[model samples]
Target: MFRALGAVLAAGLILAAAQVPATADTRAPARFSEFSVTPTSLDVDHPTATYTGRLVFTGADGTDQGVPGARVCLDKDGRCVATTETDADGRFSSPVTLSSTGAQPQLRDGEAEAFFNGDAERQSTFVGSGIALHVTQVQARITMGFDHTPSVVGDPVEVSGLLERQTPDGGWIGVVGQTVRVFVDGTRIAEGTTAADGTYRISTRVPVSDEGFWGVETPLPGRGYPYTVAFANTWQRAAHRTLVTGFNAAPEPVRKGAKLTATGRVMRVTADGSTEPATDYPVLQFSADGKKWTDLYEDHPNSQGYFSLSTPAERDGYWRVRTEDWPDLPSTSSVDYVDVGYRTAISGFNASPEPIAKGRRLTVAGTLKRDTTAWKAFSGQSVKIYFAAKGATSWTYEGTAKTSSTGHFSHTFTAAKDGTWRAIYAGSTTYVTVTGPGDYVDVR
Candidate 1:
């Protein structure tokens, strides 16, 4: 009876053992043979980078073998940010885009890792012991230009430009609502905020500088981006400034062949808005049509910034003063228009028959001459005959006479009463009006 019972028990145990499933894995353990993240440094603009490595397992024969179709992942701060499956050769490549929140705290002080979760056939492991990465803020650049070239002193200068940040693909995008500052000769003068389009405009009256070096920049500090980098090649330029006032050309209706004087003040505007006499010279220029100009003369200003230039009047034109092109100062004054008329005279006047009967024919004659290099006959001119009663304040107009080729004019009129007779020549655009000497004519 005992032998029979043992046999049944052994059979039952064998049956139970056969029904139970196997729990042990027959595949080799898996691990990363090699793993690394390209371009250890990262930034907000270029937040994405690549991570590549190979997943391998120890083979049954004790040689490492490729673990094909295995999964691998990139871990950052204990979180899986990117994942990829190994190819036929156990190699895997995946892109990792860092989040702003993830990158902010790690700016200049963070690292990334590669991890793998164990599968049914392999044990879990990671290969990021020596691999390291860095997260950094994006690079910024400023491009700008002055609204007006060659700015004037004591006047506002407007500077405008776009602000941009570098991208991961080497492209650029505008940085909106950022503050930008302007500097003149290394001194901060103005600042403004960017618009939605990344454009900004700043206007300010910069102090005077001999070199006149101007530039713009964006400083990154205490603005939530401490690691942000600003390019050294910010927008820079060299410019000049000048101030000229109180310009005048005297003798508005200047007579031809007479001396005409031009006066003005040339000053330098200091940083404090004070004016002082500039040591530069002033050039006197004349323009016939106000479009083209000719340099007439130049002179230095006195201690009080006053200067005077004299020249002979020649024709109707415009005049202006231009500050000499000095390395430190340059400027131009407002234009002044001058009217110059030619000098004219009347000679050889005669009125015949003094103390005669009334209603007699009277003759008036005169020679009209224009003064140029020398006095010459003025032809094709009209002359009027005038008469004034004895001791009268004004003269009475009679008739007109045309001048001959020799500039001699004669007019005959019927006299009525005793009066003084004279010939007058009206002025033209190029000549001045003149009256001939009066001759007494009597009519009874």
Candidate 2:
């Protein structure tokens, strides 16, 4: 027994010496480095944003180094989720999905830790300073629309909307006492605060800008809330509305050959609540029907923002002024009107019996028309025939004829000598005057 005990003691000393090399080889310290967290601002209601981080090792020489195969863990409210190994650069990042398994379903502060297997000294025992990780709560909802569509430039356009929040019971309720801003063509034109029930309205006389789309924005304060520089988010990022109106050409029944003017104005609210001109020299337009507007090349606005374009009113049509569509503002059309009268056109005329003897009768005929029904015949129209001898410098009135229902007119006169004959239709208040080409009747 004594001999066996002496051999066992000698074997234990040899085994202890063999383990020394393995223990010292694992002495590298696991330390956290520059760990960071994002989503400094997250909505309490949605809370869908992820939290991500990094880690490095502390060498024996007290220097930062990336340690591979070391475990790192994330903690929220003191309980922890398991860590993954430090990667190529000693960096590890993952989202903090929840507080912890079996913990409360609530917002909580979070931290990070690094651990080395089989070493208690290198594992994290307390939260470190200068590290950020959190779950935040700040939420909002917004809705907007225009009260009056197709409004005039000087008319009050009412922009209204609601600011709401979700209740614990999953129902949405209004947010009261919050300020909301309204814009036209990217310019702030009005503002209002939410009422007790969460509704907001602003009836401001705005200038005509672009065609129609307006903007509405509302920012919520993060004080005493979850959002800071990191949690910077809001519901106003998507508020866009529209202000609509129509264009017109005033005063119908514009007589033929008279000048008709085109006109419109745009009024905009300044930042200080004063009104000013919204657009310059909007394009003048005309259309036979109200549906399609054509650009009128002749007229534009004067220096004082007054628009007038004189165009011959020869055909019946509609007229108005319009602006181009912009990203922030809707294209606009002003209310105006145009009713053109007729333009007279002599279709044709001729003298029959090209060669006639003296004392023989000659016949002259012609047709008259207006543009109302596109070259429709003009009945009961008076057509005057004129005669001019071969050497006569001016024509003399010969005879008159009334047009039939088909726009035909005729007259017979004695052919006393070689002469040229012509037909003319004196225009009325609605139709323009016209004359047909002369026809020669040679009398021998």
Candidate 3:
């Protein structure tokens, strides 16, 4: 029984010894014979770079030999971003896509490392520092348009444009949801965000400046990326804030063939909200229908910024003053309307029956004529007849009469005492008012 227990114990010990694993061979130091990363710069246009290297070790015969079937990886920030295996020549090629958050690549220290883990016979090694890596921002461009190219101070200006970025294939694509800023004479005035289609719009008032120049810019979208500066095109002329103010045209009911005057002031608004006289010349224009205008006169404003222009009153029309079409300053004033009427006169005025009995009927008559190129009868006009007692200081309102188509007007009044009579035609928008010569009548 003792021999049987001892045999079983020996068998257990032999089985346990047999189950033990064999010791591994010592690892040999290995290195990358030729390791390089192609196109060290990465950008939105070219987001992928190539990593290539060869793994080698000293063989038992003291000669360098390839370590085949070994795994290689490209690491960034200690994390593998790409991996591949060595071929029969111990050469490996791997594509490294930058780790990105949104459209921005994650980069630190602007460097990368290519590494290999150890195997039973080869020790681990990596490409050391001094390998240059850069995260470059994509190339960008902008196109812009102004709602009012020559804008006035205190008025809003709208700017719109598109933002585009270059692609790897040398093509352009719109950049979405990016902030765009507007600058007037190097000062940022307004900002807006790009839409889904890369279009952006901003509205801001024209800032006061002695010399105005407008421009636009868009910074690179992501952090830790290098930028290439670019700006949109700007307007050609220096900005100006000039306007015509307090415009007037008179007389309100001017007669034909008479002088009509237009007056206004041309002022320049400054950055501090103060105004000064502008030396620019102003033009007086006339419009028959208020839609199309014709230049009537041009003259420079005085030191006080006031200008007066005169032209013969012709037909009814609108009048306005505007600054000359200067390269820097262009402005217009509010319009004024004028009513022009023909010159009118009373002719052949008389009161019949110079000597008459008491209570006799007295008749007063006259012809109303309007002058254009020539005199013509003006019809459908209201005329009044007045009477004054012979030594009376004031005339009495006797009666009213309308001129006929022949321009003739007459009225009858019963004369009870010695008096002087006259006919008067009141003026209208188309004809001038006139009073006829007085005729005296005596009651018998």
Candidate 4:
């Protein structure tokens, strides 16, 4: 019996030693070297933009670690900007400012990388892997037409709109109590705050300009509230409570072969004797037949909001002139068409270098093929050129010249600088239509 008991004890001791808790050799310290952010791209169209709401970092072993920091720096083209960091729960938050000119505030194309000293005891850098953010600023619409040319300066001009806010659903959330800042030629002029109804009223002195219209910028403060920039002149009036307005300022008609240049001032008529210039608006020139037209000039509104555009030679037919409203003024025409002449079909012709490079001589040259070869020449057809730029949607006339007796027409357009450009040719009484969307070219 004693020998059997001793054998059982020896077997139990051997089993216990085999199980020995797998030994200290099986345990090791963790090491990592890689990190990333989520979503991969940041879009800046809304003032209140957010990432997937998190920063995700990765390690050399493909393991994830949360980044901890209240602030992160991002550089664009050379300008560096900072964003706030996450909270203790591994979340960071920050307000994005969209009004910095040096930073390329339009968030659509801006980007940055996030980094932090994470787990200092391990000497590891917590960096997010492959994260993207889409951010944007809220847009503001100013009341009145493109050119405000009010007949008087210092009169109370009512400006109203919703302070747009952005929501997490990648959409806009309209809010009230936003501040509207007024600026003229890059200078602050006045400010007003929006009410609960998302509207603002401001009384300000008009900036000095040859034309009454002034460049106006309204910046709303908050996360993702984009700065709004616009122009207003005194020549046109708001038709009703809605933002729509009509250009009451008419062009002084000119006749063909006449030496008289079309010259005039644009003003907005008000109940009071006050007047504002239409400089912020562009001056348009229409052909006598009213079918073909050209833009002549864009002038800055004078302190009194006044502007004038002159044609060097006498105009041949009926011409109309006006500024373009934001959101585009309702026009009877579709697809930006113009009639050139009789018996020739010139369709799908696109123009290039909109606003026709300023000071640089531009050749308004494009392929001109008539459906019917029987129509040999587009002779003496009046080819008119129009110009505009980023700030100016309204077209201005650079110059107009007639085509030679041959079927081909070319005009030397000399502008003061580079801008968007388009051209139209008036052939006989019929207008020629361009074939496709106008082309854009950079001369500089």
Q: Any runs in candidate 3 off by more than 4 Å, and if so which?
A: 1-179, 193-213, 219-225, 236-247, 252-259, 265-280, 285-296, 302-305, 311-323, 327-383, 386-397, 400-431, 434-444
Task: Please give each candidate's TM-score.
Answer: 0.39, 0.28, 0.41, 0.27
C-alpha root-mean-square deviation, candidate 2: 19.6
Error of 1 at 21 (Å): 88
Q: Quote the RMSD, in angstroms, for model 3.
A: 19.4
Model 3 lDDT per residue over 3-76, tens place: 99999999999999999988965788888888887888777556677888888888879876888999887777
Per-residue lDDT over 284-366 for candidate 4, one digit per residue giving the tens place of the 0 to 100 score: 45565666666655555465544444453333344445555432232221111122232343333444445444466666654
Cα lDDT tens digits for candidate 1, 1-444? 999999999999999999999897665577888888777776665667688888888776988788888878787656677788989988988887765431123323355677778787778788748456665667678787777763455566688888887777888878776777777777778888778777889887755656667777775542335236342223333323556788889887677878889998887766557777776788889999999999988987888878999988888899998886554367889999988887778899888766667777777888888887788898898999899987789988998988888989898878788889888877877776777888887677
Clashes of each: 3, 29, 0, 110
Q: Which pairs in model 3 have colliding backbones?
A: none
- Better model by TM-score: candidate 1 vs candidate 2: 1
Per-candidate Cα lDDT values, in order, are: 0.76, 0.61, 0.78, 0.44
- The sequence of per-residue lDDT tens digits that candidate 2 reaches over residues 200-304 is 887776555554456676643344333221111112211112222333454455556667765555443443445544444466667777798778653434554
Judging by TM-score, tell me the better candidate of 2 and 4: 2
Give candidate 1's total backbone clashes. 3
Q: For model 4, give the 10-residue run with minimal summed lDDT.
A: 236-245
